[model samples]
Target: METIFGLDLPTWWFLVVGGVFTGYAILDGFDLGAGALHLFFKKEESRRIALNAIGPVWDGNEVWLVIGGGALFAGFPVVYATVFSAFYELFMLFLVLLIFRAISIEFRSKEPMAWWRQLWDVSYSVSSIMLALSLGLVLGNIIQGLPIDDQFIYRGTVGDFFNPFSILMAITTLSLFMMHGAIYLVMKTENRLYAKLTVLVKNTTIFFVLMFALSTVYTLLYLPHMVERFKEVPMMFFFPVLTILAVANITRQITKRKYRFAFFSSAFVTAMLMALVAVGLFPNIVLSTIDPQFHIDIHNGSSTDKSLKIMLTFAVIGVPLVGLYTGFVFWTFRGKVKLDETSY
Candidate 1:
């Protein structure tokens, strides 16, 4: 009930939640995007080249996800429990896809057999699609609000979890990630692979643009409360506008085959869009449709000031180090990928 330093715990909860997801988008966005774009590489060597571009960083990129889960469990236990409980099936399915994709990324490259690699390629691409969709669905569910009972418990049925609004959100997320991956592939690969990616990104951009339009409609119609929240805040609206501009720029650049700039714009758009969502969900972490009293703010869901203080100290010390390590890895491996034709 008390404020921490200045702001309440709920505010900090939102900060951490938003920070983690935004960071993940910037880090894993390209990685997963590359996986989604993996289908564009028809030749085995081309595909392998794309994989190598991200091979060293993909696993580390996943650490943000772990950090997000850990933060939710420790800082916002209420939100974590309610969301997972209500979407048990979805979460389980998401886990399976994530694990399968990770494994396939490594194992697919180990074997030279055509069928073997094809199977893993399908697994990797499909898993990326599902992961992106599930992420969008989760965001939709949050924005649309959830069914909570008197005891502050979730009352969602299996079928209820996948409403039309959530499904549209899933499509939007998937399309955005696909575009993100396409741009990244174009940025990192060279030769025919890069040439092929320019065409792939052009095609993918159309789908993402369509999805963005549809998602706008869905948000306005189905999540009026969320729309209202954004409308009431003038500054907050800029992020989405900037995101749209960035997406448009990405498309324009990809048309001209400006690979690096398009990738940068795509990543920028993803980051900005995530920030917009986090801003939209501010003050209220979990909105209850049944009763306003059932709503959970960050403070109600967070640990004590002492725990936060300790972790904040550690986070301050460790975050920059993680950033440095990430930078070093990318810098060390910075260049176009070239796969061994003899190997898988």
Candidate 2:
């Protein structure tokens, strides 16, 4: 492949999106996972502990969302606009849920009143569930494709958003996050709560495994055309298999009370799964059933050569700065969370 400005445009866009989304998953994955665990915390102190585990870093973790969204808008505006318009109602509902959850996280501990704190705790957990579900549904719908007219616009309604594949994806996302959160708690906390998290992981790992298997089967069933491709490229199976091994390692380590390595292993598993999906779906940024031409191939959906070249130049200068800032924040907040009576 010929390169422009030391990089191919379409490949660069794919890399950008893949990098941004992976960052979002690893960073915000814990935030959502922690929030999902809110209802599990029975005592006020426990709830505060859960909240504090994510407190110092949650806000910064959310910056990945902004970066991911901004990258999509700038790098692939058409895809962004089309998908957003297609799922306008669903997107709005998702945003509202996310906002409520974000607000509740900050405002929930403002008072010592049992009712007020409990109410926000409920909101946080519910909102986290909805957010994860919505994100999974969006992925499912995109992978499944939608009706579009000659104008290259989506011609689907809100009801079309909840198909079997999409729902399966929602469950997969929910399960994945729950497991991810549990791994995080193991890493960051000790005492009864940590032991409880270990027990929770033991209890939930089977369900996570089952849900993953079901989602894989459902996706393969729905998208049978890709089966042949996978068959031809047998090496592609390595990532999924590695993910399984990683999960197994995480379980084994947790059983041995190796919290630190367990968390890192879980994160590695997620990254491998993501890489597998990206490689599996290469060349086709968006698949379409209505017409193959309707599919948004990376080559076709990319910006002009001039635009990409210019963007490449800016990326070279700016991406390093983003990396530096992200690193600094993570380093500054590297310790386990401590929730005192007066701490926020």
Candidate 3:
């Protein structure tokens, strides 16, 4: 096993893949959240404003998903193949929804007719909600362990993915994204919409907090293995503590009308939550419910050392470029969204 800075190649690749997905969650989360709340804005102008708030960067944010998929396939082809095979229908539905979401965003403002716009609005909101829920369902199953046999083949049916824990995780994911999106909208609007979002932000915050609490309790009680790593390494407790503080600070910053800070807090919460998941699933990319010997770990799931080394070189150069481009886009579009003739 080739080591870089003491950690093995697969572990480095694990962090890289995890980091890319975390970026996707933080970047695209707000826009999806905004889309989920679209129907709540009854007025056409309000809907347009909400859409325009995310208009400039929504597609750019999705680039992270592409990067994540590529990284997953590059680093852990076995896990990718098995997981995708296991969730084939769900992933296909997710892809269809993503396409519908992109189409709704692009076609929503093309016509002046109320029926046309209303149709796309419903499509957009429903797709966003489903996208978030689907992501949660996948994450939940991953954490709960899949029924993988010794050959790394998933033995579970599609129906098996819809357990109560996955459903709870799905809703919790939606609530967190809603909170994140509401804060972003609050930061990007003025006057009426801002005021409306202030009220909505509080509600979303409450919604996320309640859901998070329930998820934590459920994990502690039923999913004991998820917390085993933290118990083994007490210092890893800091991540969860920081996650709690970040969640707490979101409401604090919102109450103080520091929306920029609140938005940052929300992003931090997303990152921390993903980090917690990574920590819990360390070494094992996919756990097996069938038997302990069936786990697909970083070592067994990864590519050759030489391949990882070559890809790491590319990733080192390429990831920074992507980050720079993302930063530039946000910096260029940094301000309250003003509706113009060109607005979405």
Candidate 4:
């Protein structure tokens, strides 16, 4: 048990993996949110403006996902293998939808025909919605505990992943993303589109608040285990409290027409929510519903201490470089999106 700042190596790696995925969710979430709201912008110019709003950086945002996945595989191979195997079909579908979503962004403006653009618009919106929902479903199922046996093998069917709790989580994820995206769009547009998006931002905010409230009530009633950590360690309660404040500030900033602040608030809300998940599932990467003995935790699920030590060195150097690059890209593309002949 090599210690780093009072915590074990595996715990540090868990934090690393969680931080990377949280970055992915916050960065990529807005684009997916924008895509999910694509069809709502009916007019060609409005849709194109929306598409261009995310065009310069959507692909770059996915780099965090790749990093997160790699970190997961490196740090927690057992949890990776078990979860991926358990949700093989769902992951495959998620992959296909990801491909379609990427292609829709690239190919939507290739032709002048209404039918062609309309086809890709539907594909884009549907793929974005499903992608967000699928992520939520996976998170919900993971938090709720999986049916894993003693060997760390999942024994549940694919159908088991579609339970009511998971569905509620999926909807909540979608709504949150939608609200996040609308805020980003509002920040990146002006005039009529900006005004329209302000209205949308409010609506999406309401939608997310409703879904979040329902999810909160459902979890408190049915998944009481989630709150046990906060109860045991009262300090951990700050994350949820900060999350509520961030959610509240989203509306406050939006109402004040400070969309940049609103967008940052949304991103903070995203980070805090993920932090809540990490806090709730600390130590245990995957919980087994069948038996506590089957639970895969940081210690059992992680690689050798030496491996983590070596990879941690690389991560220290590499992750900051990725962050710098991401920051540079966003800085370069700062301000309103203007449609041009070369725009997508």
Candidate 5:
């Protein structure tokens, strides 16, 4: 019941968690995207450059995910337990992929054998793509709602996460991250590889735009209530509008061969789109399709007010520290990725 600038503590913590995921999506997203497009770089050196482009930062990028997961468990224990139990299989696969993805990168350069390199490359790319898809599937299932019972328990099986809408979202998310990763790679390469990616960027742009458009139409047609928040708050409509403009800017920057700007625009587009999702799902961390009464909202799902306030205090001090470290690392490694003996 306590308010911070008129918003309650649980709501504030929701924003914190959402913000952490947004950071994760933008940071780890590029690396995952880079890995998705990894196999496309045919030449060995090309692949190394691509890997090294993300090498300094991929693991660090995952730090946000760790933080986000912790925040979810801390702030919404019930929702976390229900969703995890329901999506157990996918989560298990996701965990395996995460481990493999890291090992793939680490072991790819351990041996110079063609078979060794090929094996790890396959593992890395597959894990990255699957990781991105898994994330999208989870979000899509959340948006579409689960069969949560009155006790805030998920009454569905693991297979339920694979519903058609979730599949569409997985593909769309892959395309989006592919494009995002390609842009980041472009920023970190030059000469022949850069030329190839100039073309790749254009193609990925078209791919993402097509998939995104199709997803939008499908959501509007079948999942129209996603627009409910926008309808309720006319001002909220501008979020999508700005996202559109940012999308346009992506093409414009890519065409101008200004990849850094294009990368920024792509990152912005991600943040804005995620903001839309956060807005659409505000208050309800997990929706219940069977009955609204069974929904796990911020109020019902959150820790006690005293707990939230204490968590918020740590979050207030902790988030900016994470943000600062993230910025410092990126700045330290800024500019084109140069290969060396240590490169992977």
Candidate 6:
């Protein structure tokens, strides 16, 4: 791979993939979060409003996931191949839930029957929560290190993915998404539903903070190597500082009833957290629990420089266009949701 200012093309591709994933978390996160909180809205109108809140852009937001996955595969086929082979069942489950979530929204309002709506509502919320948990579980396992051999094959059973720290992270991810969704709902609702979401935002914020704190403590106490870079470079402290500031801004904006600012802060928090993860796991695409030398990183895992360069060209052009489309969708639907015959 070509090098730019000491960093190779593979490393640059890694950053691009990470950035794309961060975009996914920030965009689709509120979509999942809103679904996760579906049961909280008991009234029929409240649920519809919540569903419609994400109706315009949910599918578009998921494009980032596709792009991120593609970038990973194109840039580092080894990581993609190894991860997919290892997490086949988990990914299958994710796909099932993903389908359920979509239908739950479209089918919910199709029939006026109570049981029918109830079924879809439950499906939507449960599927959303499961999706969030799955993402967190994958992240936790990646951070904790995986049981991969020198041949880049996973040795551990699927059951081993659910360690204590990973489980906690799954919960933390759920809480974070809940908080993000609540903040979004607060922006897209009014009257009783808006008022209810106001309270939810506060509580979810607290929940996320508590969970994040506990996860941090666990990582610090048990997974010392995770923070090795932080200790080695005093300047790496900025990421944590940025996270704290962004979280504090979330609270500040929420307290002031500035939904837009609060929403941006929530996005910022996601970006900062994901950035830290990327920085912490730099070079190493997947950490090896069995042996350090078995670790999969950019150099050993990446495609040829020719392929990376071509993909980089596509990415450079594609990312901004997607961003523009997303921004345009948000701009089009930039207000509290009102139920019309057209609304889902």
Task: Report, for every candidate in turn, its global Cα lDDT versus the true structure.
Answer: 0.79, 0.77, 0.94, 0.94, 0.91, 0.93
Model 6, residue 269: distance off in Å is 0.5
The 10-residue segment with the lowest total lDDT in model 3: 276-285
Off by over 4 Å in 1: 1-6, 340-344
C-alpha lDDT of residue 30 in model 5: 90
Local error of candidate 4 at residue 331 (angstroms): 0.5
Please give, for residues 1-344, the per-residue lDDT of candidate 2 as tens digits. 55856877878877887787887787777778778877987977777878878777777777778877776766776677777788889989988997998889889978878899888999999999888889889888877777865566887778888899889988887887788887777667778887787877765566677888898887677776545556778877777788889988977887787777877887787787677667766777666657877877677666776776677677667666777887887778676767666665
Error of 2 at 102 (Å): 1.3
Please give the RMSD of candidate 1 to the true structure.
2.2
Clashing residue pairs in candidate 1 are 10-298, 10-299, 33-181
Candidate 6 lDDT over residue span 24-94, tens digit each: 99999999999999999999989999999999999999999999999999999999999998888999999
Q: After superposition, how far is residue 206 of candidate 2 from its true place, in Å?
A: 2.3
For every model shown, what is its TM-score relative to the native structure? 0.92, 0.93, 0.99, 0.99, 0.98, 0.98
lDDT assessment of candidate 3: 0.94
lDDT of 5: 0.91
Candidate 3: tens digits of C-alpha lDDT, residues 62-98? 9999999999999999999999999999999999999
lDDT of 6: 0.93
Model 4, 1-344: lDDT tens digits are 78988988899999999999999999999989999999999899999999999999999999999999999999999989999999999999999999999999999999999999999999999999999999999999999999999999989998999999999999999999999999999988989988899899999999999999999999899988889899999999999999999999998998899989999999999999999888888878899999988999999999999999999998999999999999999999999989999998
Native-vs-model 2 lDDT?
0.77
Best by lDDT: 3
Deviation in Å, model 6, residue 265 alpha carbon: 0.7
Model 1 Cα displacement at 288 (Å)?
Answer: 1.6
